[model samples]
Target chain A: MATISLGVFDWLVIASYFVFVLGIGYYLKRYTKSENDFFLAGRKNSAWVAGLAFLSANLGALELLGMTGNTFKYGMYVAHFYWIGAIPAMLFLGIYMMPFYYSSKIKSIPGYLKLRFGEKTRVLNGIAFAIMTLLVSGINLYAMALVLRTFLGWDWDVSMWVSALTVAVYVTMSGLMSAIFTEIIQFFLIWFGLFLVAILGIGEIGSITEIMNRLPESFNTLWSTSGDAARNGMEVTWPAIVLGLGFVLSFGYWTTDFLVVQRAFSARDLRAARMTPIIASFFKMAIPFIVILTGLTAIALSNDPGSGFSLLQDGGQVNYDSALPLLIARYYPTGLIGLGVTALLAGFMAGQAGNISAFNTVWTYDIYKSVINREASDSHLLWMGRVATLVGVLISIGTAYWAKSFPSIMDYMQAIFSWVNAPLFATMLLGMFVRWVTPNGAFWGLLAGMGSSFYMFLAVKFQWFEAKILTLSSVQSDMAVNFWRAWWAWLICFAVTILVSLVTKRQEEKDLVGLVKGLTEETLGREVPFLKRPEFFALLSLVALVILNILFW
Target chain B: MASEVREMKSIWFLVGLVLLVMGGLVLLAGVVELFSPSERQTVLADTHPGIWWGAVMLAAGSLFYFKNRK
Candidate 1:
């Protein structure tokens, strides 16, 4: 941990935003009038809020630091992973998959499975989703902890607890609506802060050409058609990037993840939900530019022959993830550094608490009450939701510290979660599209998917004892770094689900008319009443005003 | 309604096929790299052209969908 110094002004600016977030959290408390209000923002919110929240949730600490490290290391491959991989996935989601959830009026994805299939399928899907949601909690908490340690030099325990406390407080108090509003504010602060640092960096270094001239060839290694990241059966070539990053990351996110779906579920209507992510997709496209650019600029700045990038220590190879914070601490005066540090907190807490709140509501309403105890009163349920919030925060904070002991915790967290997610996604998509996908068929198929992927992941990830029965030694290599073979996790899961569904002759398919109830009629206006043009124009105006950075000071 | 639904479905199939193709190729390349660990870097560097191909197909598909929507 670095011995950090912040000026009084810096403290004030950082404190100001904290006050602002708390203000929003306290302010939105009035809106949490019921379980629905807390869970889904009363299902009457504007698309823009949903859109902003969706973007903020996606713009997690991963991009703040991990993507910085990624692009700094991999360069354009990171870009391809997004434009080539993620966007099209979102578009696919916006059109084809979203309708199923909206039309069914299901609270959680697992709930939808139960309705479409049966309780057996529901429990399977629920378990898988729970695993993924839990894994993600670990990943986000880990990153938040990292930022706090690097920037503020807080002890791991202190950082974890503070990060957890901030999120737990606001989330338990006000729920998703507060998370959204706070995110919109935090979203602006983070970019503004990052952009400010980026500008300072470029200005400090003088010109782009001057900056570019200072780097080694590796920093700018553009393409590698011949793959180099493959070590001992593990690989991450362009092909792998396309498959793992583009396909896996994209499809997995858009189709399966509830964070964004929760936003869509809360929208005024299906149209608003659809439009929200479109707006978010555009924002998603722009983020890597801001984040990656700041990181690259730090690289260029650090490469100036004698500039050791030692963070005041002896020259060290600049860890690109630390670029944003180091820059904030290095150049800004004390008070401004305070503001910058606080702004980084904005990015950290926005995603962290958002995940916690979503976790609480989903677990309480969808799983606990629905399955564990169905007859709880609303008041009891609300209290249970708050209790879930507290537990979710504690678990995430524990994970944040626990990750310190793991191998490349970020990557491991993502890989494990994908196993949970890949299975459920396969089953859900099949259930939606295939007519003969009977409830019984779906139940077993989903089980097969989860079982196959989990077996694959664990069989390789943990090579427990092997020589108990065989003549071999009692240990073997855990060869699970098979990024390449991991694709089959999805393939096997999807194929098995479909095969099992088709093999077991189910009863005749349910009628499709009910599913297409609102499709043909020009009920876009009636079904989804949006703000009139003037109101939309005014919303745009507010957004423009918020981005006062672009035109004005 | 039938016409629009047909158009959307047709495009969906077209796009899905292209995605599946691209996905297959990537999987092939990934499989190749599993045995050739060091070759992983070179494989991903080769993805831009494939990405470009996917992008072009996506654009063309979107155009087809939009053109028919009217």
Candidate 2:
């Protein structure tokens, strides 16, 4: 494996990125005077700003690299993650969920829980979310450092510390405002830096049709081979794809996860908030052109004997994650290589910033202000938000070092999401749509859902029971087990909430006015025409989604 | 008066500034490489992607910068 050495021009491009982000943070600091500004970017961003930031928060370098790598491994089936797995949930968030979330004026998702359920459920989710955010943030930091060290021969400790410190300074300066600003910039940098690889790869491969023809039958079609697990690279049937990834995991993360939803929370009004995820869906649908196409191009090149292209192998195993970096090394010269590296660096820092900002909000509003100091002033809480940003970054640094020691921690990311978001989605769904859902039911049902998901993960990992029992299939992939486990967890949470609510007392309808669906008054976009509504855009996104699936099928 | 006081530079303007600076540098490097090519040429060095891509960035950056420039 060759190391990617940065020349003077490359260094300049990278240095410019760092300067701009820090400068933006310094500039926004004065305007970030209020708690709302610190926590939610002043609630003043347009739909476009919030929308790109919303998508960019989740579009980390690890996702870029890993998805491209997974495409090389799983073929077109990996597109399920971006398409059926994400777009539907995003549209659902904009169309059905944003009204409740935005209208409540809650600082965080946990704040909404406190209003709808009780203090117990809110605190439980707050604590869980805070832990999950730090762990994921730290893991991202570790993975970023690892990628730099492996590909560029950079020192791991330096990579980790420098990137972490940079994120700390920017995020602590103006909190979510700086985070959103950097994320939107990162969005542009990624498209400019990485999309070129797809274009160049297409140039090398002659055409997308030629690239598709070079692949084995198992790797080409999206849904055609999904009927039987044996016929596809993913080794899972359509049911698992639809139920697990599309419904449970996608809805859970997109609608409920505060990291992305907080971007929408920053929008100036309910209409912009609703439009945030709707606009984001279009971009999210387009990302596969960068990742998936480049991956198929990698496969096409490797299959050609005269091309002399092969993935880097470690310990006799082919490293799929090497696909994107190796492609950059193949196509990009000096100046462009620097741009590509900076794009990856921007991604790592923005993702870390997103997590830390989300953590600070949840810790300050949901935990500190709610439980530690109930009558804290706005200015004081704002101060605590900055302090929490520092503490969160430090904890993430510790987590990164821990991940460095145990690299296997990266494999547990999907499991961690299942434990937290899967069950919480069920509770959120019931609590919002069903007015009869009691606070006690939400607390207990969430606890059971999280517990069951974790238990199932451990049961499969340790071989306490055969995984077939959970997956209900003789042949299974790690992804298959993950989807089925999430589905089961969500179902358990849904059922338990219903049963517990039957026996327990519910919140009064008057008290649940803005939080729950039936009790809340619907004030959709009456001033705007039907064509300009979020619903119309969501319908268009859905139609695009259907056409894409059918075309690929 | 209140509106004037509250006005701030949009995020797009900053995005444009960064792109313009970086794109200019890349284009500069590309032209230098064109006259005296680097010893270690990449797989498709004959195509000189840096020049074209840099020009594209410059064009896009200029559009964003001028449109949003207050």
Candidate 3:
């Protein structure tokens, strides 16, 4: 594609979005008068709002750029991240897991750890989470800034600073509410913009079948990628996708990640809170159409010479991340180009703000209040929350510079998940379900799991071991390697926790009742009126998921 | 439903209003591009994505805006 220039209209569209974000923060500032208000929006969000925020919070540049690039690189196998990887986990969180989380009334996942295990587990997880949140924020900041510089010919640092300052100001001013409010807007912008690309690209290509016909046979099938590494474009087999990504990594993210869970925590009531993830699942089921299809379209365009995409590098390798922007420039005219760019900016900002907001809450409630000042006033805590948001964004900016070392933003993120999330999820699963799992078991299990995952990560990335356990021949790509690492790490944590729990003292039954599954009765209490029942929503999402899998199979 | 709406603050109304305006501007732009003969070939081929997407946004924004209007 030729050097694309933005018109006055495009700048206006982006500027207006920024102004609207700042304006929302200013308007909501007064409502954030207390710690509860600042961190949880006083638990006032309705189901629809919370659900949108939940989906939007996760729909940042990671989904826009990272997933799109991965889809371009890996083909249909990348859709697993949304479908089998996310949908079931989201429903499980809503239908079964959220009651423990909501009823326990803890502010962060680490807070729940303190109640279930002890200070050791809580502090260890809390510090790790806080650091991880900052790293994730930095990854998002770096990814967005890089994409903007590539697409618009803007200075990288300038793009990074502008985004960081915009997110920081509103987030500091109105806290989580601002981040969420902006996220809802972003949700719309991103969908519309992505829809524009998908619809136009499909029109240009004639149909999904036509596009598939033009691409390699390996790129067309989702389940068929497993037979041989040489044949599978993704270098991942079905077992890896099902066991590694679908079971461990997916559940780890949707069920436990405090960044996304914070949206549900902000819901007005238990029903709405539970409904949040379910509603998000419905949207999650459709995301592949917007993201994955665009990547496929870019792949089709790149393979056909004289198609004007120009995404190929020196080694016959596609600059996979450039797929989204190249598509935008290819199809969109001047005015629609503005909307598309706004959508890109919206996704970037939403991701940054989501990370920062989650960082603030975890810092204030989990770390600062619990460790540094146990008896601080709510007002003082609220002040600390603002400070944490500022500090978090600054640290993220530094991390963004560090993040440049990674080959791709998505690879860095999946590696982090392997190290932190797999172990954390194992602990969460045992802690919430198995009442006999002692505090010592949970704490030590987490440490063992995280340590082992990190070691295996280094092993895989460096080809450190000749042993089959250390070397993965089934998976061909670094991304697939990360997935299998998470799987192994989770198993270690699960085993260690069970072994340690049997020898250690268990918690009192009274203390564990509402916090553990099967130990509590009707945790959700009343039925959710037929239409809003989680099962009904989950079933609908599941049906759609099955049909999508079949259609693409 | 009423109770749910009652809990909503003005910030949501602002959300709806912003979407309505943004969608309206985008829809107008799409309409202009549709009418302009010179821009037709250079734009998205045979697809008026802006108008269609703008209408969707208009509907979505209005739902958020008017649902809490009372």
- Number of the top candidate by TM-score? 2
**Which model scores highest in DockQ?**
2
Off by over 4 Å in 1: A206-235, A310-320, A405-408, A459-486, A505-508, A511-553, B1-70
Q: Write the per-residue lDDT of candidate 2 for residues A166-205, one digit (tens) a residue.
A: 8999899999999999999999999999999999998888
Q: What would the TM-score be for candidate 1 when compared with the true structure?
A: 0.75
Runs with alpha carbons beyond 4 Å of true place in candidate 2: B1-5
Give the backbone clash total of model 3: 0
DockQ of 1: 0.01
Query: Which window of ten consecutive residues has the lowest lDDT sum in model 3 chain A?
Result: A466-475
lDDT of 3 by residue, A1-553 (tens): 4456876556667778888998888877876788888888778888888898999998886677777888888888888899999998999999888988988888888888998998889999988988888988898888887777777878999999998999999999989888888898888888876777888889888998898898887888877656676677778767778878998999998888999999999988888898999999988888888888898998898787877665635367667778888788778766677888888888888888998988898888788888899999989999999999999999999999988776455466788877888889999999888899999999889999999998987775677963246326734677677778889999999999999999988889888878888787784545547665777887888898899888878
- Which stretch of 10 consecutive residues in model 2 chain A shows the poorest summed lDDT? A518-527
Q: Estimate the TM-score of every prediction.
A: 0.75, 0.99, 0.94
Model 1: docking quality category: incorrect
Fnat values, one per model, are 0.00, 0.57, 0.27
Evaluated at residue A52, the lDDT of candidate 1 is 73
- Of candidate 1 chain A, the 10-residue stretch with the lowest lDDT total is A467-476
